[model samples]
Target: MASCKQVESMIQAWIDGELGDSERVILDQHFQECPLCTITLRKQQRCAALLFEGFADHRLRHSIRQRVMENLPEMEPLRVDLEGVNWRGHDTKPKRAWLGPLMRMAAVFILICLASLLYSAWPKGEKNFDGAVGMITQTEGAAFRETGHGLFCRSVALKDFVKFGAFYKTGPNSHLMVSLRGPTQLRIDENTRFQICDDRKIRVETGRVALDVSRDERKFRVLTPSGTITVYGTVFEVSVDSVQTLVTLQSGALQVESAGAQGELKPGEQTCFTRGQNAITTRTVDTAQVLGWTKAIMPDSEAYDRFAREVQPLKIAELPGEQVFAVITTKNGKPRAVSSFCLAWNPATDGEERCGYDVHVYNEAMHELFSVHVDGSVFANPNRRSHEIDAPGAPIVNAGVLHVKIVPDNSAGKQTPLKVSAVGL
Candidate 1:
């Protein structure tokens, strides 16, 4: 059965008889069972009737007969033939000779009248509605090219209209955002330059852009020096530099075509196109990490430390120190019920580098929701000396507090010091 909200939303379409049969059935059943909905439907019908009644007084002021006759083809004069006619075996001259002329006049008048009525019923000129294809909705530290005037010092203004061939450039710390009628949302990354080729295409001169495109009949294309990324309703990011263009899919799917080679990308997958390479290279990626900057979140040591202190240990012989790197929460301060997590782990010594740790996550009721095993290499890294672990399946609940416990494997003795930090994605 359709919910009350769904039925209410389609009430206008229902009254217009524009809904599909299945949808109409759902709304009908809901209205029958719900008296409030029934009353609302009746009121809507009454209001529609009253509104249409106002148009009944409208009248056409022009003469229909003249307009109709002017649009019709020229008619020849009518002629009557009596060559073979005979009456009672004798040639007969018609007594009603004037009847032919009168009939012709009547036929002309009736034809013109009929043509006038039909013309009057036909629709008038339809007005074309010109809507924008895209607009710059937000910007920070970004600038736009003025074609012969050079670059402007400021970013594009809110709701600034975007036209074909327009160029946008962003600084190292800049972000340029755009929205299109396709409901396609875009965030241009820092040090990037791109052109609006048209509504269906964009050209990336350099840098990157994260896109959240809704399903559209026409595919959206991002062109780079190396290749083109074709999207049909997907959340993805594309980056291009002098060497290569990287396409990452956070959700949905897309196709990458370059130099007579092609490949498809799925969620959590990414592919790269090199300038001179014939075959495209594809690999797995942590989508949250790759697209986090588009969401305005970056790797912050302060945030990492804050989340690290919230780590708790479970029943293990020893616990390496654990840290919370990030908390993936919304503006409302509620942790996403299902999201990714970035965990950083540091081992105390190389001897215990290969150890495994069991991670437990619980809801507010202290009920275990799920657990993940952290491989030892997660605590090993050459640069940071700490491995960044991408844990994607964390089940958070409405109550919002995550009770996480980390326990080391039996290979480790008591009093093991493991440094770990985690961030929600």
Candidate 2:
């Protein structure tokens, strides 16, 4: 009979249907008698099921779906003809005779156009200027170039190529996240410079980069700030913080060593080192947290700015008793002279009683730009209305510092002051 620890180790494999027959027999016999092992196996099975369910849900995010689709070149549509008529037993019309070939030609042309569009849309490759570099592609955008000194932010589309680089910085903040399309290998050299040579070998100079390697057969390696990292296929995160270096294996297995103190790290295992030290300590770390850099979300400034810009009111002035106002401001902070003004108004009491008012806008120089009128009337009662004003473009040239004045209706006596106040954008 196996010990409890040994049984527990094999239980997950058994539930997953991954154990060999001999291992299965041993587990089955033990489960029949050991209530603890049986319960443990059942619990593990449930956990596996839940984990898979969560994974399925996560795969639905747009980023994951886009990546999956990009990798599946086989899904590209094939061209085919649909207009061919069968002539096995009967005669076909002359128009039908040419239809099959015509359709085929059309399909070919469409396929060629589609392929060209997709190729143009693919992500552009990046050249590493320093420590290291890699290439990434999608169906859009030009190739991107990236260099690593410390931590860097990249567009999600650039993440697929796993191209990254790092250089020695005396300060503490040197880190970078290199996106990967598949499992990648990187090498760091002590005071050296190198590039990701294909997807198999990583050339490095005297700096190190943390790697979040995927599970694909793509070879992953790193030239370190001090030495080299050779890895078997696995998912792991590696980092070199100054004189110290660390490698954390989240899944599968990996080998790490510096100055000949070598250690094999299994899933959930991590190793750390300092220069000239042979001591290697193995500890457990959360794999997801360590590799979180690979999947980190970047902040979007443009979208945030757009929202902020649209929410604020433009700097136009409103009439005192009116519900709405018109504003004018320069693109920057500068102000210009307003030489003319026009207002078309609506009467609150009746639609037919509306009238127009002509107002002149002038600059400090007393130059006239153009003029128009407000087409509504104001009585003692508050009447809400709006009007459009047209002016020559010349007066608004220097955008900042412009002033507007409303000319009262001569028929209503100058006593009626157009209630007005200025607002800033």
Task: Please write out the lDDT profile of model 2 over residues 86-110, one tens digit for every residue.
Answer: 1233445765888899999999999
- Listed in order, each prediction's TM-score against the native is 0.39, 0.29
Candidate 1: minimum summed lDDT over ten consecutive residues — where?
A: 309-318
Per-model lDDT: 0.63, 0.48
Off by over 4 Å in 1: 1-131, 149-155, 297-425
- Per-residue lDDT of 280 in model 1: 62
Which runs of model 2 end up more than 4 angstroms from their true locations? 1-134, 137-194, 203-219, 297-425
Candidate 1 local Cα displacement, residue 200, angstroms: 1.8
Error in Å for residue 114 of model 2: 37
Which numbered prediction scores highest in lDDT against the true structure? 1
